[model samples]
Target: MAIGITAVAVPLANADVTTKANPEGIDVSSYQGSINWSSVKSAGISFAWIKATEGTTYHDSRFNANYTNAYNAGVIRGAYHFARPGNSSGSAQATYFASHGGGWSKDGKTLPGAVDLEAGCAGLSQSSMRNWILAFYNTYKSKTGRDVVIYTTRSWWSSCTGGWTGMGAKSPMWVAHWGVSSPSIPAGFPTWTAWQFSSTGRVSGISGNVDRDHFNGSAARLLALANNT
Candidate 1:
């Protein structure tokens, strides 16, 4: 049986308590102003994970347009993927990301670019899929020289990522395991820098809804993440 939760869109009165550990966030498709960004800013929302590129043929239409709004509101923002499945080895998807990632610059603040791998795609071998991911990462890095972050569940990390110990330095991790507390991150997988804990979260200042995220360290640490990378 599935558990039920009665959720309301609460303002960040106790944001310090709420945005703790792997804090609250919403994974959004569009903005409608349903969430209160002022309250979110006042409430201390740590970060936002926005949808950027998807398949080679499709990208998030609203990402670049909306990211600036979030940034101006003092929200640290990141981007995610929807995985092209069989086409993971294609360069088009990478190019799409490279073109539409708002052009990250030196000393210009931008969240790490991330690849969201899931079971949405079919008919691709593990090697083929990994090749697709590498293609995107390699090509994008060649243009930007920035490392790419990987967003996956624990199971995907184990089966698809091979052993985390062997991952290249260009890869960081964003593990999704929504629950009350942060879950056990895999050892060979790598150190997860962010955790998605609750999808049921509601923050002020966003329209319709948004995904709330927490940097896996103190606010000081988060500053380091933003300034360094």
Candidate 2:
């Protein structure tokens, strides 16, 4: 139902996205330990995607604290996962997000939510792997009534998610591809909603490098992801 094209400035790239400009967000991982919340607040980071869980049993010690800090500072916030360990573990991680970050306002909008799946954790058959990923996706959908964006590499996007739209056709996508000025998204894939183009980004609060994200829609669309709208 949402449509348009915008070139989000990512320290790189101009892909085919629907909306005004690419929205800017950050994916914070353990790399951002001992953060200076004040510096992050001052850096004008419009949004943050924090690591919530790793496997079925491992959770980020900093997720709750980071979420609270971002919320307090009025930075739009969301959560993501390190997926692809296996299907069973994928389902477990999804459940983790549902219990922790899936709730929405009375109006039923949520902060943006995502699942970061890649090859190489414990590589299983593709079908089995997708089934496991779907288990989590289905749960998140049931809880939020909104699609959780899927983040994966260009290669994976081409081969993995090409045939699946089990979540919904209108759900947004977040693509991860490093290097080059910009990379075109694979054909058959819906337009991108977020582009994670760098793992070497330097932000004020972080000591080491951080992954930088760009939104493909307007400020309003991001608010929708945040469920603020």
Candidate 3:
């Protein structure tokens, strides 16, 4: 979800993607307002990641509500930061994310915090952006005790980070590739932990299109990842 804004038109989700995997989930933010998490869970959503903070200053206004409600509805929940690396230092952004809403706890259900690295890095030079991402990654890992997931499309990661392989050794990946048989992860990551396959997904509770995702492992393995075990 985009930071500090509401979505006007989110296309309907492709229902066909669910056939390829079990234990699928969704990612959402302030864009889909007032979601009925009960319906979402009932519709077979096993997990969720909510937008918590962006850059170093902005917080998702709907974070607490969605976070608490989603947990109460029995969805394994996680938090993510919509990164703006060009705007602020990654350490500050990590600290800001942890302070407001992006911290992850090992309750056996909360996945590691993620950095949303989409087009937010536009205009920044490749080397500076790489260093910026490292700063965020190290700080977030130190604070949360879990490696952050680098969420990006293959083209974007390749274009911005120059396909730096060091990032994948410690950081897990969340690759977004819409309408493909398999996610085209960049060269760095060994395997993707999560894949956001579609942005225009329709579920029970969300009024508009929500992002659909899939974990690469079984439900037990997913819990272990969340527990950081």
* Candidate closest to the true structure, highest lDDT: 3
Model 2 TM-score is 0.79
- Candidate 3 lDDT over 104-208, as tens digits, reads 776655777888998655688889889989999889878877788788988888788787887877787888999988989876787788899999999998998
Return the candidate ranking by lDDT, descending: 3, 2, 1
1 or 2, greater by lDDT: 2
What ranking emerges by TM-score with the best candidate at the front? Answer: 3, 2, 1
TM values, all candidates: 0.76, 0.79, 0.89
lDDT of each: 0.58, 0.64, 0.79
**lDDT value, residue 108 of candidate 1:** 25
- In candidate 3, position 195 carries an lDDT of 91
Off by over 4 Å in 3: 1-21
- Over the stretch 182-207, how does candidate 2's per-residue lDDT look in tens digits? 65564445677778889898889779
C-alpha positional error of residue 88 in candidate 1 after TM-score superposition, expressed in Å: 5.1
Question: Which of candidates 1 and 3 is the stronger one according to TM-score?
Answer: 3
Of candidates 2 and 1, the better by TM-score: 2
